[model samples]
Target: MQKIVILDYGMGNLHSVASALQKVAPGDEVVLATTPEQAEGADRLIVPGVGAIRDCMEGFIRPGFVPLLNRCIETGMPVLGICVGMQIMMARSEENNGVDCLDIFPQPVKFFGTDLKENGERLKVPHMGWNQVQQKIDHPMWRDIENGSRFYFVHSYYVPAENNDALAGETEYGVRIAAAVARENIFSTQFHPEKSADAGLQLLKNFVDWNGQY
Candidate 1:
């Protein structure tokens, strides 16, 4: 049986992500992995987080799962990162008065300007609500999902990856932001797929069926 593990390092909306995975991939064995051993054995993995970047990294450290995460990425397993999880994959973050990250993507997480505005109208800081995402590149995870699909977003900061090729999806919030990023074995999204209704579910379904292709 295929083993799918969601890293349970005590910092994410674990229940929602797990429930979404179960609903999408009922046939697969999904486990909330709190140890490196469990996480390392998974055929596919998800690193989901909801909180400050510093706290999230601290959560991983408290359980000593950083090596496991590095191993997963090194072995090229299918991995997905959501929200703060994705942000921490970058080099560093401006959050928590500046925090260092895992440096998986060689990018930095930047905070949205407080004075952000659209058409001379002030916009919210968190960029909360349904927004259209433009698919920046073709990949297996985006196979069935249509371009400009609306996904739920709630974030005060965004990753503007230095490598344009790594960008998979783009969304605008007073300015363009990287909504999704991808490389060989990793795919991540700033938007919450579980909260995105039909389009979100479809993306999750695609992820389950994906073979870690670019």
Candidate 2:
């Protein structure tokens, strides 16, 4: 059975994400790893996070954690990042008075700003609830999932579509946001796939079956 390691740096919805992965890929071994050594030999790695970027970065500050992630990516092991998990992959986040991230993706995670309106209606700060994602490019992660499928989202900051050639999916909330991104062995989503119903389950399954390729 394949070994799927979900990095538990202490900031994500670990139980929920683990439950979802177990549900989707019953045959695989799903592990919650707190340290780099614990994550060794993982066939696939999942980085999941919730709450503010500052807290998430704190968890990531652990020694050898960042290097482990980089090794996974360099070796072509499939890596899936979720929500704030996705944001941390960027160069930096504008949250917590600005925080430097993994810099895997040379893009900045920006705040939605105070004023946001769609059709003249004031949009909420934490863009909660469901929103449709428009697939920008073809990839294995999109397998069997529809192009405009709605996914659960809850965030005040987003990765803007600027200098992001790895943009894989887009969703609009006031302005356009990079809902998903992919580069080589890595794929990440701004939306929560674990909470996104069947479509989300399908996405998890795709990651399980993905061979770290396009």
Candidate 3:
């Protein structure tokens, strides 16, 4: 059976994520790893987060975790990042007066700003609730999940599509936000698949079945 390690850096909905993974892949081993050594023999890695970027980074910086993550990326192990987990994959974020991230992707996370509007009406700052994601690429992670499928999101900051070649999905909230991104062995979602219902569950199952291919 494949072993899936969900990196628990003291932030994120760890129990919910783990429950969802177990529901999707009944036979697979799903572990919540608090340290890099706990994540050692993982066949797939999941990084999950929530709350402020600075706080997430502080918790993310375990002595050997970053190196282990980098090695996983280089070796083509399937990795999935969720919410602020996805944000930290970028080079940096505008949140908390600019926090440097893992730099797995070249994009920068930007704020939604106070003046966000759609159809001449002011939009909310933290874009909460369900929103449809427009698929931009045909990756295995998208298997069984329809284009324009609604996913649960709760974030004040987002990654813009500009200059980001890794953009795989897009969603609008006053402006277009990079809802999902993919490259080589990595796939990340700004939306919470664990909280996204059926479509989300299918996506998780697909990840469990995927072999880190394009």
Candidate 2: tens digits of C-alpha lDDT, residues 73-168: 999999999999999999999999999999999999999989999999999998998999999999989999999999999999999865779899
CA error at residue 25 for candidate 3, angstroms: 0.4
lDDT of each: 0.87, 0.93, 0.93
- lDDT tens readout by residue for model 1, 143-207: 78899999999899898734556899999888778999998999999999989988888888888
Q: In candidate 2, how many clashes are counted? A: 0
All models, RMSD in angstroms: 1.3, 0.9, 0.8
lDDT of 3 by residue, 124-190 (tens): 9899999999999999999989899999999999999767799999999998899999999999999
| lDDT for residue 78 in candidate 3, whole number 0-100 | 97
lDDT of 1 at 55: 92
Candidate 3 lDDT (Cα, 0 to 1): 0.93
Model 3 scores a TM of 0.98
Name the better of 1 and 3 by lDDT. 3
